[model samples]
Each structure stands twice: as structure tokens, then as C-alpha cells.
Target: EPEVTQTPSHQVTQMGQEVILRCVPISNHLYFYWYRQILGQKVEFLVSFYNNEISEKSEIFDDQFSVERPDGSNFTLKIRSTKLEDSAMYFCASRDTGRGNTIYFGEGSWLTVV
Candidate 1:
């Protein structure tokens, strides 16, 4: 079975720096989503994309963030400016189909902003 993969496993950066978290979503999946879980908080949705455009996005996806399907196998999330509050585990997930398919998470890219 195919699975999502994220790079760097852990990242450390100072506030205001640019950071790009990378992921390779499951092949043949139609919907892709980005979510984050702060150290002690629940997982929160950031954005969801399909058909090459955003299908849904949460308030957490602000001006500092952007996402792209850079290639057939890679999806990326870029944070133009990082903040302390932005430190969290970012996850990439894909749905095999719209109904009944549960979105699964990658191990995650743990961002540490200080």
C-alpha cells in the first residue's frame, strides 16, 4: 500500500524565516489536504485541494501560507514567514475517494519556530 511521506521529520527555525514543508501524497488519490497539530492541541485542517484548485481552507491558512503540486508525486506547503505560533506538526493526507475513505496522515514534518 502507498503512503504519504514528509521531509526532514523535524525542523528548527527562527521566527520570520521562510520554511517549506514537503510531502509526497499517495498516488492515484484525488483529494489532498494539509493539517497541523500543535504540541498539545487537536489536529486542525489547513487546506484541501482538488482538481488543481482549493476545494476548502480553514482560517489557519493565511497570507503566509501557500501550497502546490510541484510534480506528479510531490505536494508542498510554503510558509513565507514563520512565527512561534506556527510551530507544529504539519501533516499531508490523501483520500482514495470522496465517501467512506478515511484520510490518512504522514508521520509529519515537525516545525519548531523559536
Candidate 2:
């Protein structure tokens, strides 16, 4: 099976700083997404993108967050002015174009804001 890949497996930054996480979705996948899991909490959806545009976004995705597919293969998530509460494991995900297709998640980029 194909897989999603993320960079900077772990990052530690000061509060109020900026961070950009990168991901490479499965080559054949058309739908991409960003999800985050706080310490021990359940995974929460952040945003989804397709066709070079945002398809949906959760309330958690505020002005501080942005997503982009800069090229054909790379997808990125940027967080501006990070906060302690923003510390979590951000997972990149992708799914093929089909009804109820399985969504595959990356190993995750762990962000630690101090």
C-alpha cells in the first residue's frame, strides 16, 4: 500500500513563533488533509484540500493556520504565532478518489511549543 510522508519528525519552538510542516501524499492520491492529536486526545481534523483548493476545514483551523500544495507532489501546513496549546502531533493524510476510500496517515510531525 502507498503511504504519506512528513518532515522534521519532531520540532521544538518557542511560543509565538512560526512553523511550517511538510508532507508528501501518496503519489496517486487526490485528496489531502491535515489532522492533529494533542498529547493524549483523539485526532482532530484541521483541513482538507483538493484540486489546489481547500475543500473543508474544521473550526480548529483558524487564521493562524494555512495549507498549501505548492507543487504537484508536496503539501504543506503552516502555523503562525504558535502557542503552547498548539503542541501536538500533526499528521498528513491522503485518500484515493473513490467513495469511502481509506485515508492513510503519515508518521506525523511532532510540534512542541515552549
Give all TM-scores, in the order shown. 0.96, 0.98
Tens digit per residue, CA lDDT, model 2, 1-114: 678999989999999999999999999999999999999999999999999999999999999999999999999999999999999999999999989899999999999999
- Predicted structure with the largest lDDT when compared to the true one: 2
- Give one digit per residue, the lDDT tens place, for model 1 in 1-101: 78989997999999999999998888888899999999999999999988888899999999899999878888899999999999999999988885899
State each candidate's clash count. 0, 0
Model 2 ranges with Cα > 4 A deviation: none
Once model 2 is optimally superposed onto the true structure by TM-score, how far is the C-alpha of residue 27 displaced, in angstroms?
0.2
- lDDT against the true structure, per candidate, is 0.92, 0.97
Model 2 reaches what TM-score against the true structure? Answer: 0.98
Query: For model 1, where is the 10-residue window of minimal lDDT?
Result: 95-104
Clashing pairs for model 2 are none
